[model samples]
Target: MNINKEENHVQSVVRAAHILQLVANSDHPITINQLSEETNLNRTTVWRLLETLEFLHYVERDLPTKGYQLGYAPYRLFSKNNMYLSLIRKARPLLEKLRDEINETVLLSVPKHNGTLTIDQIDAPHSIRPINLVNRLLPSHCTSNGKLLLSRLSIEEFNLILDRELEPITRFTITDPTLLQEELNWVRDHGFSLSLREWDESENGMSVEITDNRNELIGFISLLGPYQRLSKDKMLTLAPKIKSTAKEIAEKLS
Candidate 1:
């Protein structure tokens, strides 16, 4: 093989991989121009690589913004990875126990960009409970799990999220950036966070952090229910129990 030709091929593969990393790390959907600027590559090269990646299901276009985001291939690979599966398996019994004890929804969620993604949940036994939120991406500014996760991020990372619009889901949702920042500070101090009719008018929730062996936040354990059943006072009363359950999960994962 020609040495120069082989080197060029290797360089192209490296550039493509770099592009993928940039898209994966972005909190918002990234445009071809943005990718080009970030990767220091020409627009044409970036577009070509994105097209190939899109064809392979590694990335896809966000139609609304005409930007790019991770596609199904990465998620498929993640699902096959034993780590996440192990986490779910190890945490299930404890989550079930919490649900049984409280008769409210208990969930395991982790940060996804600027939002929280519910990985698993044990639904409340009540017929009139809040709808299932598993596998949903929820706003960081308006959710208990989301706020808990956000509190763990670095100041720079947190600012990146605040730079974007804080869409209000309900009148109770905190849309003012300054107020949200103050609330996050309180969450950091309190070791727990709450969403009192913020995401849904009838729903309320509270969450505690789950840390790894290194004491790094890895996820959140949340309790959610109708406002009538999960009043602020009741959630405060149950906070210790939820924190205890989160500790057990962290110990098991470690």
Candidate 2:
């Protein structure tokens, strides 16, 4: 069979790459039918391309919804890639300095789903201190990272976060959505936030936004320790330093 000029260049690999690029560029999930229409390819061809991408873990599919989304592979790739690795390396010295100054566990969190989850953490020098887990979701209504991230959200977005079931992680957890919104507003006004034994019964923390030079919300930096040791006055004293250090790190990223 004689292949036409266009057919000769219709490489499956090229088409697959184009499909993945389209999905990555979208902020929401897309369907195979949508992709087929966009690519001007038949439904069978689009499905085959989607399957290949999914097998490589670069795309995800939801059978029930019949939609596709960018998979975790891209995030894993970014996390290990040179660009973010360099950013983390540059941020470490500042994190070390902040940890030493506060004499507590200093942490950095990035927005993930409804929470600002921990991505990096440095424990207190003392051996008896509580261990803060890295890569764990901190409750949005209770932790300093959560409030600061929530404060950055628009009113509608913030409302969506509040509508979810609130977990009372501790007696102090702000389970009331109205109250949580009020606290988030206060954090916005104050430029920093404090969580005194809210997420965990014994843990207290102070958090502030890490924003780029353009004032985009990148993440948050927080100082945390046992409530028994870090008093109210001590937390107040540490807040500005945390904010400043976060700003310094954000500048490097920008």
Task: Estimate the TM-score of every prediction.
Answer: 0.67, 0.65
**Model 2 TM-score, all chains together:** 0.65
What is the C-alpha lDDT profile of model 1 across 36-91, one tens digit per residue? 87877789989999999999999999999999999999878778764567788899
lDDT of 2 by residue, 114-159 (tens): 6777777888787656565565776677888888877878988877
Deviating ranges (above 4 Å) for candidate 2:
1-83
Clashing pairs in 2: none
